[model samples]
Target: MPKQPDPARRSERSRQAILDATRELVSEVGYAKVSIEAIAARAGVGKQTIYRWWRSKGAVVFDSFLALSDAGEGDLALPDTGDIEADLKAVMRATVAEFADPAFSAPIRALNMEIIGDPGLAAQYLEKLAGPLDEAKKARLRSAQQAGQIAPDADLDLALELLYAPLYQRWLLRSGPLTPEYADALVDLTLKALRPSARP
Candidate 1:
């Protein structure tokens, strides 16, 4: 008879399976309807298996959240094309496409509604999702400063906000179509708005 799989490998497989199941269900049904029992059944594991690792359905949904946002496979890196306008357009263009992907938007919207209702989940999302993206924005702004494209003394944090906040508002609020043209408009507007203040 074949020997039983080792515990560590078994655990890792189970974890991946659970995460995958959560992603599939949340994509199709939104986070509102996905349950621990459904996830357990989809993953071919016991409900206890899920409960043993995650304290709540929200937590599992959160992991799946990351998976889908980050290309559902791995890192969602923003490119560094060295030219601020070109680079920002490249990144934001890709981000816009990803946002509109049928596979990604619904689950994220469900998560957003959850955040609206629960302050705790909002804080959790800020920590897990928003924080890193914020840092990356700052890093991109700093790069622009170094390239002499932005004022050397610019408040990079604010600069990052100016660059990202509008696009984010458009996406989260559905205020406009997140088209490539829209993203390019943002790139132009950002560079123009941040153009070095005139010296007296």
Candidate 2:
């Protein structure tokens, strides 16, 4: 008799297949046009399999994006180097590179537009995607504050906005190029603003 496959392995394979199918479909057809049926057919899985793991088409697409980011370079993590500025610049540069990738840009732009138009979807996106990244950055900022790299009273939330908003705005509006140099500049400006005051 043939040996049976491991259930956990089979489950992971199905999950990865669904995510891969979603990513390819989103890139080809855009997020709004991709459906659960299409993903199920593409992944060679039943519709029930997709529904078993994800609540909706949007959730699957978000997970696909997350998987892509993780496969690319574990995008959810921020460096915890003692040099806070260097750590932040590293993260920003990676973000700029991802934003510039055509495969990522198109689908992410579609998702952003979708979230903007739907409050419920926007909340979901924030919770699943942006919220984790925000928490990671805030944790890094708190670490820096404890180390005296940043002012103790600095608002980490606002600091995060200052660090990321310029690059995001440029990507969203096509107002300027999203480049490593731009990312570095943003990091420098933010660090300057957050740096602890010099003792007289």
Candidate 3:
């Protein structure tokens, strides 16, 4: 008799297919129009199968984005080039580029919408995604503090908000073009605000 296929492997493939299909649909059609039924059809899985794995359309969509992040396959860490300013500039510019890319931006827009409406999904997003990424960035800021580059007493959380929030707002609102120059300016302005306080 032929050897049977591994059930665990088969299940993993199905799960990934579901996530890939979700990402594709969300990109092709805006998040508001995507349906679980459509995702099931695209993934070649039954609606019951998706339901068994995910509680709602939002949950599935969230996981699909999470899967993209998880593709990094290791603990998250920002670059440490000893110069906090340069490192931050590089990171911000990369973020701007991502927001400008349709492949990345589309799914990210979908994830943002899903999180906004579902409190539970929002919490999951914080715990699973944003919280960890924030911690990684904070680690760099903490290193800067030790180097006397940033005020030791600076609130790292606020420092991060100052650095990133405007870029995010502009992207979300389509208020302005996201460009390399814009990213650099945000970094310069935030670093000025975070500079070590002068001694009296």
Instruction: Supply candidate 1's per-residue lDDT for 174.
Output: 87
Q: Would you list the C-alpha lDDT of every candidate in the order shown?
A: 0.78, 0.85, 0.86
Candidate 3 lDDT, tens digit per residue, 37-145?
9999999999999999898886787678767753235456888989999999988888899888877787798768777897986887787667878999999999999
* Number of the top TM-score candidate: 2
Q: On a 0 to 100 scale, what is the lDDT of residue 54 in model 2?
A: 89
* Candidate 1 regions with alpha-carbon error over 4 angstroms: 1-16, 24-38, 46-59, 71-77, 198-200
lDDT per residue for candidate 1 within 1-200, as digits (tens), equals 33656877889899899998997887678666789999999999999999998888877777667766554455544667888888888877887887777566766776777778889878877876676667767777778878778887777777667767887788788898888998788889888877776689
Alpha carbon lDDT at 133, candidate 1: 69
1 against 2, candidate with superior lDDT: 2
Taking all chains together, each candidate's TM-score versus the true structure is 0.74, 0.86, 0.76
**lDDT of each residue in 157-196, candidate 2, tens digit only:** 9999998888888999999988899999999999999999
Deviation from native of the Cα of residue 35 in model 1, angstroms: 5.6
Estimate the Cα RMSD of every predicted model relative to the unseen true structure: 4.4, 3.1, 4.3
Identify the runs in model 3 with alpha carbons over 4 angstroms from their true place: 1-16, 25-60, 67-71
